[model samples]
Target: MGLILGKISVETPKYQLILKTADYEIRTYPPSVLAEVTYDPALLGDRDGGFMILAKYIGAVGEPQNSRPEKIPMTAPVITHSAEKIDMTAPVVTSGGGGSTPITMQFVLPAKYARAEDAPQPTDERVRIREVGERKYGVVRFSGVATETTAADRAEKLRKSLERDGYKLVGEHVLARYNPPWTLPPLRTNEVMLPIE
Candidate 1:
Protein backbone atom coordinates (compact mmCIF):
# COMPACT_ATOMS: atom_id res chain seq x y z
CA MET A 1 0.00 0.00 0.00
CA GLY A 2 1.13 3.59 -0.78
CA LEU A 3 0.11 7.01 0.33
CA ILE A 4 -2.48 8.91 -1.72
CA LEU A 5 -1.71 12.37 -3.01
CA GLY A 6 -4.35 14.76 -4.23
CA LYS A 7 -5.29 15.29 -7.91
CA ILE A 8 -2.73 16.73 -10.28
CA SER A 9 -3.50 17.59 -13.92
CA VAL A 10 -0.91 16.59 -16.52
CA GLU A 11 -1.63 19.51 -18.87
CA THR A 12 -4.32 17.58 -20.76
CA PRO A 13 -5.65 18.97 -24.02
CA LYS A 14 -9.27 18.82 -25.21
CA TYR A 15 -9.16 17.54 -28.82
CA GLN A 16 -6.98 16.36 -31.64
CA LEU A 17 -4.09 18.12 -29.97
CA ILE A 18 -4.49 15.60 -27.19
CA LEU A 19 -3.74 12.79 -29.61
CA LYS A 20 -0.51 14.44 -30.63
CA THR A 21 0.57 15.14 -27.07
CA ALA A 22 -0.88 12.53 -24.72
CA ASP A 23 -0.39 9.62 -27.11
CA TYR A 24 3.25 10.52 -27.47
CA GLU A 25 3.64 11.00 -23.75
CA ILE A 26 2.22 7.56 -22.96
CA ARG A 27 4.44 5.86 -25.49
CA THR A 28 7.56 7.57 -24.23
CA TYR A 29 7.54 5.83 -20.85
CA PRO A 30 8.27 2.21 -20.04
CA PRO A 31 4.88 0.51 -20.01
CA SER A 32 6.44 -2.77 -18.91
CA VAL A 33 7.70 -1.49 -15.56
CA LEU A 34 4.63 0.58 -14.77
CA ALA A 35 2.11 -2.21 -15.43
CA GLU A 36 4.11 -5.01 -13.87
CA VAL A 37 1.38 -6.57 -11.70
CA THR A 38 -1.39 -6.90 -14.27
CA TYR A 39 0.83 -7.96 -17.16
CA ASP A 40 -0.70 -11.02 -18.80
CA PRO A 41 1.75 -13.73 -19.79
CA ALA A 42 -0.69 -15.18 -22.29
CA LEU A 43 -1.14 -11.87 -24.04
CA LEU A 44 2.62 -11.51 -24.56
CA GLY A 45 2.61 -13.05 -28.04
CA ASP A 46 5.73 -14.04 -29.92
CA ARG A 47 7.85 -10.89 -30.48
CA ASP A 48 4.69 -8.73 -30.58
CA GLY A 49 2.64 -7.96 -27.42
CA GLY A 50 -0.97 -7.05 -26.52
CA PHE A 51 -2.39 -3.69 -25.44
CA MET A 52 -5.70 -2.12 -24.35
CA ILE A 53 -7.01 0.98 -26.05
CA LEU A 54 -8.57 3.36 -23.51
CA ALA A 55 -10.68 6.24 -24.78
CA LYS A 56 -10.99 9.11 -22.27
CA TYR A 57 -12.82 12.40 -22.78
CA ILE A 58 -13.23 15.53 -20.67
CA GLY A 59 -16.73 16.31 -19.38
CA ALA A 60 -19.20 14.69 -16.99
CA VAL A 61 -17.98 11.32 -15.81
CA GLY A 62 -18.93 8.55 -18.22
CA GLU A 63 -20.81 10.87 -20.57
CA PRO A 64 -20.30 10.05 -24.23
CA GLN A 65 -19.47 12.90 -26.57
CA ASN A 66 -18.27 13.27 -30.14
CA SER A 67 -15.34 15.35 -29.07
CA ARG A 68 -12.34 15.73 -31.35
CA PRO A 69 -10.17 12.65 -31.67
CA GLU A 70 -7.98 12.60 -28.56
CA LYS A 71 -5.12 10.18 -28.21
CA ILE A 72 -4.43 8.48 -24.90
CA PRO A 73 -1.62 6.08 -24.10
CA MET A 74 -2.69 2.44 -24.19
CA THR A 75 -1.79 -0.36 -21.81
CA ALA A 76 -1.19 -3.89 -22.99
CA PRO A 77 -4.64 -5.53 -23.25
CA VAL A 78 -5.37 -8.34 -20.78
CA ILE A 79 -7.99 -10.83 -21.93
CA THR A 80 -9.94 -12.94 -19.48
CA HIS A 81 -10.57 -16.65 -19.90
CA SER A 82 -13.90 -16.22 -21.68
CA ALA A 83 -12.24 -14.22 -24.45
CA GLU A 84 -8.86 -15.95 -24.32
CA LYS A 85 -9.22 -17.14 -27.90
CA ILE A 86 -8.27 -13.70 -29.29
CA ASP A 87 -4.69 -12.77 -30.05
CA MET A 88 -3.23 -9.86 -28.04
CA THR A 89 -0.23 -7.90 -29.31
CA ALA A 90 1.62 -4.80 -28.20
CA PRO A 91 0.97 -1.54 -29.95
CA VAL A 92 3.28 -0.54 -32.80
CA VAL A 93 5.93 1.92 -31.64
CA THR A 94 5.72 5.02 -33.78
CA SER A 95 8.76 6.92 -32.42
CA GLY A 96 11.42 7.55 -29.73
CA GLY A 97 13.16 4.24 -30.25
CA GLY A 98 16.10 5.00 -32.44
CA GLY A 99 18.53 2.87 -30.46
CA SER A 100 16.72 2.19 -27.21
CA THR A 101 14.88 -1.08 -26.81
CA PRO A 102 11.12 -0.82 -26.46
CA ILE A 103 9.54 -2.14 -23.31
CA THR A 104 6.40 -4.35 -23.25
CA MET A 105 3.75 -5.26 -20.63
CA GLN A 106 0.14 -6.48 -20.23
CA PHE A 107 -2.92 -4.42 -19.27
CA VAL A 108 -6.24 -5.54 -17.73
CA LEU A 109 -9.53 -3.68 -17.82
CA PRO A 110 -11.71 -3.79 -14.69
CA ALA A 111 -14.54 -6.21 -15.68
CA LYS A 112 -17.00 -5.60 -18.48
CA TYR A 113 -17.66 -7.17 -21.87
CA ALA A 114 -18.23 -6.14 -25.50
CA ARG A 115 -18.06 -7.62 -28.98
CA ALA A 116 -16.35 -6.26 -32.04
CA GLU A 117 -18.74 -4.14 -34.12
CA ASP A 118 -17.88 -6.00 -37.29
CA ALA A 119 -17.90 -9.45 -35.81
CA PRO A 120 -16.36 -12.43 -37.63
CA GLN A 121 -13.94 -10.05 -39.30
CA PRO A 122 -10.45 -11.51 -39.01
CA THR A 123 -8.94 -8.19 -38.00
CA ASP A 124 -11.86 -7.12 -35.78
CA GLU A 125 -11.76 -8.82 -32.41
CA ARG A 126 -14.01 -8.93 -29.36
CA VAL A 127 -13.06 -6.60 -26.50
CA ARG A 128 -14.02 -6.18 -22.87
CA ILE A 129 -15.42 -2.90 -21.64
CA ARG A 130 -14.43 -1.95 -18.09
CA GLU A 131 -15.27 1.13 -16.07
CA VAL A 132 -12.40 2.62 -14.10
CA GLY A 133 -13.71 2.89 -10.58
CA GLU A 134 -13.39 6.21 -8.80
CA ARG A 135 -10.72 6.20 -6.15
CA LYS A 136 -8.03 8.36 -4.54
CA TYR A 137 -4.58 8.30 -6.08
CA GLY A 138 -1.22 9.88 -5.39
CA VAL A 139 -0.08 11.97 -8.32
CA VAL A 140 3.27 13.58 -9.05
CA ARG A 141 3.50 16.18 -11.79
CA PHE A 142 6.63 16.32 -13.92
CA SER A 143 7.87 17.71 -17.21
CA GLY A 144 10.65 16.03 -19.15
CA VAL A 145 11.50 13.07 -21.34
CA ALA A 146 9.35 10.19 -20.02
CA THR A 147 12.23 7.76 -19.91
CA GLU A 148 11.76 4.51 -18.00
CA THR A 149 14.09 5.62 -15.21
CA THR A 150 12.35 8.95 -14.69
CA ALA A 151 8.85 7.45 -14.58
CA ALA A 152 9.98 4.81 -12.11
CA ASP A 153 11.71 7.41 -9.97
CA ARG A 154 8.67 9.64 -9.81
CA ALA A 155 6.44 6.68 -9.04
CA GLU A 156 8.72 5.68 -6.19
CA LYS A 157 8.69 9.16 -4.71
CA LEU A 158 4.91 9.46 -5.03
CA ARG A 159 4.53 6.06 -3.41
CA LYS A 160 6.74 7.09 -0.51
CA SER A 161 4.90 10.37 -0.14
CA LEU A 162 1.55 8.56 -0.13
CA GLU A 163 2.74 6.15 2.53
CA ARG A 164 3.85 9.10 4.65
CA ASP A 165 0.35 10.55 4.18
CA GLY A 166 -1.34 7.31 5.32
CA TYR A 167 -2.83 6.28 1.98
CA LYS A 168 -3.16 2.57 1.30
CA LEU A 169 -1.93 1.21 -2.01
CA VAL A 170 -4.84 0.20 -4.23
CA GLY A 171 -3.88 -0.69 -7.80
CA GLU A 172 -1.13 -0.49 -10.39
CA HIS A 173 1.02 2.57 -10.97
CA VAL A 174 -0.19 4.74 -13.90
CA LEU A 175 2.12 7.03 -15.82
CA ALA A 176 0.24 9.77 -17.63
CA ARG A 177 2.43 11.38 -20.28
CA TYR A 178 1.12 14.62 -21.77
CA ASN A 179 3.54 15.89 -24.34
CA PRO A 180 4.21 15.50 -28.05
CA PRO A 181 7.06 13.16 -28.84
CA TRP A 182 8.68 15.84 -30.91
CA THR A 183 8.89 18.06 -27.84
CA LEU A 184 12.30 18.15 -26.25
CA PRO A 185 12.68 15.68 -23.39
CA PRO A 186 13.11 18.44 -20.84
CA LEU A 187 9.89 20.15 -21.94
CA ARG A 188 7.52 17.16 -21.79
CA THR A 189 4.96 16.76 -19.03
CA ASN A 190 4.44 13.39 -17.37
CA GLU A 191 2.36 12.35 -14.40
CA VAL A 192 2.92 9.38 -12.11
CA MET A 193 -0.34 8.09 -10.60
CA LEU A 194 -0.87 5.33 -8.04
CA PRO A 195 -4.36 4.30 -6.99
CA ILE A 196 -4.85 4.26 -3.23
CA GLU A 197 -7.43 2.90 -0.83
Candidate 2:
Protein backbone atom coordinates (compact mmCIF):
# COMPACT_ATOMS: atom_id res chain seq x y z
CA MET A 1 0.00 0.00 0.00
CA GLY A 2 2.84 2.34 0.88
CA LEU A 3 4.63 1.54 -2.37
CA ILE A 4 1.50 2.31 -4.32
CA LEU A 5 0.86 5.51 -2.38
CA GLY A 6 4.46 6.61 -2.74
CA LYS A 7 4.37 5.98 -6.47
CA ILE A 8 1.12 7.77 -6.97
CA SER A 9 1.38 10.79 -4.68
CA VAL A 10 3.12 10.45 -1.33
CA GLU A 11 6.83 11.22 -1.11
CA THR A 12 9.18 8.78 0.58
CA PRO A 13 12.72 9.20 1.73
CA LYS A 14 15.20 8.62 -1.08
CA TYR A 15 17.90 6.02 -0.59
CA GLN A 16 20.53 4.26 -2.67
CA LEU A 17 19.92 0.54 -2.69
CA ILE A 18 23.23 -1.22 -2.19
CA LEU A 19 22.05 -4.80 -1.88
CA LYS A 20 18.81 -6.78 -1.86
CA THR A 21 17.87 -10.26 -0.77
CA ALA A 22 14.77 -12.29 -0.08
CA ASP A 23 14.88 -11.39 3.60
CA TYR A 24 16.34 -7.89 3.64
CA GLU A 25 17.93 -4.98 1.81
CA ILE A 26 20.80 -2.64 2.58
CA ARG A 27 20.49 0.98 1.61
CA THR A 28 22.34 4.25 2.08
CA TYR A 29 20.37 7.46 2.64
CA PRO A 30 21.49 11.05 2.28
CA PRO A 31 21.20 13.63 5.00
CA SER A 32 17.65 14.83 5.55
CA VAL A 33 15.57 17.07 7.79
CA LEU A 34 13.00 15.54 10.12
CA ALA A 35 10.22 16.75 12.37
CA GLU A 36 10.26 14.60 15.48
CA VAL A 37 8.38 14.33 18.76
CA THR A 38 8.89 12.17 21.81
CA TYR A 39 6.11 10.92 24.05
CA ASP A 40 5.69 8.48 26.89
CA PRO A 41 3.56 5.57 25.81
CA ALA A 42 2.26 5.03 29.31
CA LEU A 43 1.36 8.64 29.88
CA LEU A 44 -0.28 9.14 26.49
CA GLY A 45 -2.16 5.84 26.89
CA ASP A 46 -0.78 4.90 23.48
CA ARG A 47 1.35 6.12 20.56
CA ASP A 48 -1.56 7.89 18.89
CA GLY A 49 -1.16 11.02 20.99
CA GLY A 50 2.38 11.54 19.78
CA PHE A 51 1.35 10.92 16.21
CA MET A 52 -1.48 13.46 16.48
CA ILE A 53 0.94 16.11 17.64
CA LEU A 54 3.09 15.64 14.55
CA ALA A 55 0.08 15.46 12.31
CA LYS A 56 -1.22 18.79 13.54
CA TYR A 57 2.18 20.44 13.08
CA ILE A 58 2.42 19.36 9.50
CA GLY A 59 -1.24 20.14 9.05
CA ALA A 60 -0.38 23.82 9.52
CA VAL A 61 -1.05 23.89 13.27
CA GLY A 62 2.44 25.13 13.97
CA GLU A 63 3.54 28.73 14.46
CA PRO A 64 5.73 29.61 11.49
CA GLN A 65 8.17 32.47 11.14
CA ASN A 66 5.62 34.73 9.44
CA SER A 67 3.19 34.20 12.35
CA ARG A 68 0.93 32.14 10.13
CA PRO A 69 0.81 28.36 10.15
CA GLU A 70 2.45 26.82 7.10
CA LYS A 71 1.08 23.58 5.83
CA ILE A 72 3.68 20.98 4.93
CA PRO A 73 2.95 18.07 2.69
CA MET A 74 2.50 14.78 4.44
CA THR A 75 5.06 12.05 3.75
CA ALA A 76 5.01 8.33 3.84
CA PRO A 77 6.67 5.91 6.33
CA VAL A 78 6.20 7.42 9.75
CA ILE A 79 9.35 6.23 11.55
CA THR A 80 9.48 5.25 15.21
CA HIS A 81 12.04 3.97 17.70
CA SER A 82 12.41 3.50 21.44
CA ALA A 83 13.73 6.56 23.20
CA GLU A 84 14.98 4.67 26.26
CA LYS A 85 18.61 4.08 27.10
CA ILE A 86 20.05 0.87 25.71
CA ASP A 87 23.45 -0.75 25.49
CA MET A 88 25.18 0.55 22.39
CA THR A 89 26.84 -2.78 21.67
CA ALA A 90 23.75 -4.91 22.13
CA PRO A 91 20.94 -5.17 19.63
CA VAL A 92 17.60 -3.65 20.69
CA VAL A 93 14.62 -5.99 20.80
CA THR A 94 11.28 -4.27 21.40
CA SER A 95 8.85 -6.12 23.63
CA GLY A 96 5.98 -4.59 21.68
CA GLY A 97 4.09 -4.25 24.91
CA GLY A 98 2.92 -0.98 26.43
CA GLY A 99 5.34 0.47 28.96
CA SER A 100 6.40 3.68 30.63
CA THR A 101 9.35 4.22 28.33
CA PRO A 102 9.35 7.10 25.87
CA ILE A 103 9.01 6.58 22.13
CA THR A 104 10.17 8.96 19.44
CA MET A 105 8.21 9.34 16.23
CA GLN A 106 9.64 11.12 13.20
CA PHE A 107 8.41 12.35 9.87
CA VAL A 108 11.00 13.01 7.18
CA LEU A 109 10.61 16.52 5.87
CA PRO A 110 10.41 17.22 2.16
CA ALA A 111 13.70 17.56 0.29
CA LYS A 112 12.97 21.20 -0.41
CA TYR A 113 13.61 21.97 3.25
CA ALA A 114 17.27 20.94 2.70
CA ARG A 115 18.32 21.77 6.27
CA ALA A 116 16.72 21.80 9.69
CA GLU A 117 16.82 25.57 9.83
CA ASP A 118 14.79 25.80 6.66
CA ALA A 119 11.80 23.93 8.03
CA PRO A 120 8.80 25.58 9.69
CA GLN A 121 8.94 25.92 13.46
CA PRO A 122 6.58 24.13 15.74
CA THR A 123 4.72 26.09 18.40
CA ASP A 124 4.89 23.11 20.66
CA GLU A 125 8.39 22.65 22.01
CA ARG A 126 7.93 18.89 21.99
CA VAL A 127 8.22 18.89 18.22
CA ARG A 128 11.86 19.31 17.24
CA ILE A 129 13.53 19.85 13.90
CA ARG A 130 16.60 17.69 13.52
CA GLU A 131 19.14 17.22 10.76
CA VAL A 132 20.43 13.71 10.35
CA GLY A 133 23.61 12.81 8.52
CA GLU A 134 23.97 10.17 5.83
CA ARG A 135 23.23 6.71 7.17
CA LYS A 136 23.27 3.09 6.05
CA TYR A 137 20.67 0.61 7.21
CA GLY A 138 19.56 -2.99 6.85
CA VAL A 139 15.82 -3.15 6.44
CA VAL A 140 13.26 -5.94 6.46
CA ARG A 141 9.85 -5.39 4.94
CA PHE A 142 6.62 -7.05 6.06
CA SER A 143 2.91 -6.71 5.49
CA GLY A 144 0.06 -6.71 8.02
CA VAL A 145 -0.65 -4.70 11.13
CA ALA A 146 2.64 -3.44 12.61
CA THR A 147 2.28 -4.32 16.25
CA GLU A 148 5.24 -3.81 18.54
CA THR A 149 5.60 -7.57 18.68
CA THR A 150 5.62 -7.84 14.90
CA ALA A 151 8.09 -4.99 14.54
CA ALA A 152 10.38 -6.51 17.18
CA ASP A 153 10.26 -9.90 15.55
CA ARG A 154 11.21 -8.42 12.19
CA ALA A 155 13.96 -6.32 13.74
CA GLU A 156 15.47 -9.32 15.45
CA LYS A 157 15.44 -11.24 12.20
CA LEU A 158 17.06 -8.37 10.32
CA ARG A 159 19.65 -8.02 13.06
CA LYS A 160 20.68 -11.64 12.68
CA SER A 161 20.77 -11.39 8.89
CA LEU A 162 22.88 -8.25 9.01
CA GLU A 163 25.26 -9.81 11.54
CA ARG A 164 25.50 -12.97 9.49
CA ASP A 165 26.34 -10.85 6.46
CA GLY A 166 29.30 -9.36 8.42
CA TYR A 167 27.62 -6.04 9.05
CA LYS A 168 27.77 -4.45 12.49
CA LEU A 169 24.35 -3.26 13.63
CA VAL A 170 23.99 -0.18 15.80
CA GLY A 171 21.48 2.03 17.59
CA GLU A 172 17.79 1.28 18.14
CA HIS A 173 15.78 -0.66 15.63
CA VAL A 174 13.48 1.63 13.62
CA LEU A 175 9.96 0.72 12.57
CA ALA A 176 8.49 2.49 9.56
CA ARG A 177 4.78 2.37 8.74
CA TYR A 178 3.38 3.69 5.48
CA ASN A 179 -0.37 3.73 5.83
CA PRO A 180 -3.22 5.15 7.84
CA PRO A 181 -4.91 3.12 10.57
CA TRP A 182 -7.86 2.37 8.32
CA THR A 183 -5.68 0.54 5.81
CA LEU A 184 -6.27 -3.18 5.73
CA PRO A 185 -3.79 -5.17 7.73
CA PRO A 186 -2.81 -7.27 4.73
CA LEU A 187 -2.29 -4.19 2.59
CA ARG A 188 -0.30 -2.20 5.12
CA THR A 189 3.44 -1.78 4.56
CA ASN A 190 5.75 -1.97 7.55
CA GLU A 191 9.53 -2.12 7.68
CA VAL A 192 12.01 -2.80 10.45
CA MET A 193 15.35 -1.07 10.05
CA LEU A 194 18.64 -1.19 11.92
CA PRO A 195 21.56 1.15 11.47
CA ILE A 196 24.72 -0.57 10.31
CA GLU A 197 28.42 0.03 9.93
Candidate 3:
Protein backbone atom coordinates (compact mmCIF):
# COMPACT_ATOMS: atom_id res chain seq x y z
CA MET A 1 0.00 0.00 0.00
CA GLY A 2 1.20 3.51 -0.80
CA LEU A 3 1.35 6.12 1.94
CA ILE A 4 0.33 9.66 1.07
CA LEU A 5 3.14 12.12 1.56
CA GLY A 6 2.06 15.61 0.50
CA LYS A 7 0.67 14.39 -2.84
CA ILE A 8 3.55 11.94 -3.22
CA SER A 9 2.76 8.30 -2.62
CA VAL A 10 5.16 5.92 -0.89
CA GLU A 11 5.01 2.18 -0.29
CA THR A 12 5.76 0.79 3.16
CA PRO A 13 6.80 -2.70 4.08
CA LYS A 14 3.90 -5.10 3.89
CA TYR A 15 3.33 -6.98 7.18
CA GLN A 16 1.16 -10.02 6.54
CA LEU A 17 -1.48 -11.17 8.96
CA ILE A 18 -1.69 -14.90 8.80
CA LEU A 19 -4.25 -15.84 11.42
CA LYS A 20 -6.26 -14.52 14.33
CA THR A 21 -8.28 -15.74 17.27
CA ALA A 22 -10.40 -14.02 19.85
CA ASP A 23 -7.37 -13.00 21.89
CA TYR A 24 -4.41 -13.03 19.49
CA GLU A 25 -3.08 -13.16 15.96
CA ILE A 26 -0.21 -14.62 14.00
CA ARG A 27 1.85 -12.56 11.57
CA THR A 28 4.70 -12.88 9.14
CA TYR A 29 6.79 -9.74 8.83
CA PRO A 30 8.92 -9.07 5.78
CA PRO A 31 12.62 -8.47 6.08
CA SER A 32 12.89 -4.94 7.48
CA VAL A 33 15.35 -2.44 8.88
CA LEU A 34 15.37 -0.52 12.14
CA ALA A 35 17.34 1.99 14.17
CA GLU A 36 17.77 1.14 17.83
CA VAL A 37 19.38 2.31 21.03
CA THR A 38 20.06 0.62 24.35
CA TYR A 39 19.33 2.61 27.46
CA ASP A 40 20.43 2.05 31.03
CA PRO A 41 17.36 1.66 33.17
CA ALA A 42 18.89 3.61 36.00
CA LEU A 43 18.89 6.67 33.80
CA LEU A 44 15.61 6.05 32.02
CA GLY A 45 13.33 3.87 34.12
CA ASP A 46 10.11 5.08 32.59
CA ARG A 47 8.55 4.96 29.11
CA ASP A 48 8.55 8.71 28.61
CA GLY A 49 12.22 9.35 29.40
CA GLY A 50 13.54 6.57 27.18
CA PHE A 51 11.23 7.43 24.31
CA MET A 52 12.40 11.04 24.37
CA ILE A 53 16.03 9.99 24.05
CA LEU A 54 15.32 7.40 21.40
CA ALA A 55 13.29 9.86 19.31
CA LYS A 56 16.11 12.38 19.39
CA TYR A 57 18.64 9.77 18.33
CA ILE A 58 16.55 8.78 15.34
CA GLY A 59 16.18 12.44 14.41
CA ALA A 60 19.95 12.79 14.65
CA VAL A 61 19.80 15.25 17.49
CA GLY A 62 23.50 16.00 18.04
CA GLU A 63 25.27 13.84 15.54
CA PRO A 64 27.88 15.83 13.57
CA GLN A 65 28.31 13.68 10.43
CA ASN A 66 24.58 13.63 9.86
CA SER A 67 23.50 16.26 7.33
CA ARG A 68 20.29 16.10 5.40
CA PRO A 69 19.27 13.39 7.79
CA GLU A 70 16.08 12.03 6.40
CA LYS A 71 13.02 12.27 8.58
CA ILE A 72 11.94 8.64 8.42
CA PRO A 73 8.23 8.48 9.07
CA MET A 74 7.55 6.73 12.35
CA THR A 75 5.60 3.51 12.16
CA ALA A 76 3.07 1.87 14.47
CA PRO A 77 3.90 -0.36 17.44
CA VAL A 78 7.42 0.36 18.61
CA ILE A 79 9.02 -2.92 19.75
CA THR A 80 11.00 -3.34 22.95
CA HIS A 81 12.81 -6.31 24.47
CA SER A 82 13.55 -6.87 28.11
CA ALA A 83 14.97 -10.29 27.30
CA GLU A 84 14.06 -11.88 30.63
CA LYS A 85 13.09 -11.00 34.16
CA ILE A 86 10.17 -8.64 34.50
CA ASP A 87 9.43 -6.21 37.30
CA MET A 88 5.72 -5.61 37.71
CA THR A 89 6.47 -2.15 39.07
CA ALA A 90 8.44 -0.97 36.05
CA PRO A 91 6.41 -2.37 33.19
CA VAL A 92 6.99 0.33 30.61
CA VAL A 93 10.74 0.57 31.04
CA THR A 94 11.27 -2.79 29.33
CA SER A 95 14.51 -3.25 31.21
CA GLY A 96 14.01 -3.15 34.93
CA GLY A 97 17.75 -3.33 35.53
CA GLY A 98 17.44 -6.30 37.86
CA GLY A 99 20.40 -7.70 35.94
CA SER A 100 23.24 -6.29 33.83
CA THR A 101 21.37 -6.18 30.53
CA PRO A 102 19.95 -2.88 29.38
CA ILE A 103 16.65 -2.34 27.62
CA THR A 104 16.44 -2.00 23.83
CA MET A 105 14.08 0.28 21.92
CA GLN A 106 13.64 -0.05 18.18
CA PHE A 107 12.08 2.19 15.53
CA VAL A 108 11.22 0.61 12.23
CA LEU A 109 12.88 2.22 9.25
CA PRO A 110 10.78 3.46 6.35
CA ALA A 111 10.37 1.24 3.31
CA LYS A 112 12.47 3.66 1.28
CA TYR A 113 15.39 2.22 3.22
CA ALA A 114 14.09 -1.32 3.28
CA ARG A 115 17.54 -2.81 3.50
CA ALA A 116 19.93 -1.90 6.27
CA GLU A 117 22.70 -1.25 3.75
CA ASP A 118 20.47 1.20 1.86
CA ALA A 119 19.48 3.05 5.03
CA PRO A 120 21.32 6.24 5.87
CA GLN A 121 23.95 5.72 8.53
CA PRO A 122 23.21 7.08 11.97
CA THR A 123 26.08 9.32 13.02
CA ASP A 124 25.01 9.01 16.62
CA GLU A 125 26.83 6.14 18.25
CA ARG A 126 23.80 5.42 20.36
CA VAL A 127 21.79 4.65 17.25
CA ARG A 128 22.63 1.95 14.69
CA ILE A 129 20.99 0.34 11.69
CA ARG A 130 19.78 -3.20 12.26
CA GLU A 131 18.49 -5.41 9.49
CA VAL A 132 15.91 -7.96 10.59
CA GLY A 133 15.09 -10.98 8.52
CA GLU A 134 11.57 -12.19 7.92
CA ARG A 135 10.12 -13.86 10.98
CA LYS A 136 6.83 -15.27 12.27
CA TYR A 137 5.46 -14.43 15.68
CA GLY A 138 2.44 -15.08 17.86
CA VAL A 139 0.97 -11.85 19.20
CA VAL A 140 -1.49 -11.33 22.01
CA ARG A 141 -3.44 -8.11 21.69
CA PHE A 142 -4.80 -6.10 24.61
CA SER A 143 -6.15 -2.68 25.50
CA GLY A 144 -6.42 -0.62 28.70
CA VAL A 145 -3.48 0.30 30.89
CA ALA A 146 -0.10 -1.31 30.13
CA THR A 147 1.42 -1.86 33.52
CA GLU A 148 4.30 -4.21 34.29
CA THR A 149 1.92 -6.74 35.73
CA THR A 150 -0.46 -6.47 32.78
CA ALA A 151 2.25 -7.03 30.18
CA ALA A 152 3.68 -9.99 32.04
CA ASP A 153 0.25 -11.48 32.61
CA ARG A 154 -0.63 -11.05 28.97
CA ALA A 155 2.57 -12.72 27.82
CA GLU A 156 2.00 -15.64 30.12
CA LYS A 157 -1.55 -15.90 28.87
CA LEU A 158 -0.40 -15.95 25.26
CA ARG A 159 2.15 -18.65 26.00
CA LYS A 160 -0.38 -20.83 27.76
CA SER A 161 -2.97 -20.35 25.05
CA LEU A 162 -0.49 -21.17 22.32
CA GLU A 163 0.74 -24.25 24.11
CA ARG A 164 -2.77 -25.48 24.76
CA ASP A 165 -3.49 -25.08 21.05
CA GLY A 166 -0.35 -27.14 20.20
CA TYR A 167 1.87 -24.26 19.13
CA LYS A 168 5.54 -24.30 20.08
CA LEU A 169 7.26 -21.12 21.21
CA VAL A 170 10.84 -20.86 20.02
CA GLY A 171 12.04 -17.51 21.18
CA GLU A 172 11.85 -15.05 24.05
CA HIS A 173 9.06 -12.49 24.07
CA VAL A 174 8.93 -8.74 23.54
CA LEU A 175 6.43 -5.96 24.09
CA ALA A 176 5.07 -3.79 21.27
CA ARG A 177 3.47 -0.46 22.12
CA TYR A 178 1.47 1.35 19.43
CA ASN A 179 0.71 4.75 20.84
CA PRO A 180 2.31 7.81 22.35
CA PRO A 181 2.21 8.77 26.03
CA TRP A 182 -0.65 11.16 25.36
CA THR A 183 -2.84 8.33 24.07
CA LEU A 184 -5.47 7.26 26.58
CA PRO A 185 -4.76 3.88 28.15
CA PRO A 186 -8.17 2.57 27.15
CA LEU A 187 -7.46 3.35 23.50
CA ARG A 188 -3.75 2.47 23.37
CA THR A 189 -2.69 -0.62 21.44
CA ASN A 190 -0.23 -3.05 22.94
CA GLU A 191 0.95 -6.60 22.29
CA VAL A 192 3.05 -9.33 23.81
CA MET A 193 4.87 -11.23 21.11
CA LEU A 194 7.11 -14.26 20.82
CA PRO A 195 8.53 -16.18 17.89
CA ILE A 196 6.76 -19.45 17.34
CA GLU A 197 6.91 -22.63 15.32
lDDT of 2 by residue, 60-112 (tens): 34444221377888887889887876653333325213655678889998999
> What is every candidate's alpha-carbon RMSD to the true fold?
14.2, 3.1, 5.4
Q: Which stretches of candidate 3 lie over 4 Å from their true place?
A: 1-13, 45-48, 60-67, 83-100
Question: What C-alpha lDDT, on a 0 to 100 scale, does residue 61 get in candidate 2?
Answer: 47
Q: Which order, best to worst by lDDT?
A: 2, 3, 1
- In model 2, the Cα lDDT at residue 107 comes to 91
lDDT of each: 0.35, 0.79, 0.67
Error of 1 at 32 (Å): 23
User: What tens digits encode model 1's per-residue C-alpha lDDT throughout 1-197?
Assistant: 01012222332222111112221211121111111122233444321232321122211123322133222233222211111121111111211122233333223221221222211111112222222323454566677665545665666666666676666765546455544345566655566656566
Model 3, span 30-61: residue lDDT tens: 88888777766666655434565556655634
Candidate 3, residue 10: lDDT: 28
Task: Please report the candidate that would top lDDT against the real structure.
Answer: 2
**How close is every model to the real structure, measured as TM-score?**
0.42, 0.88, 0.79
- Clashing pairs in model 3? none
Pick the TM-score winner: 2
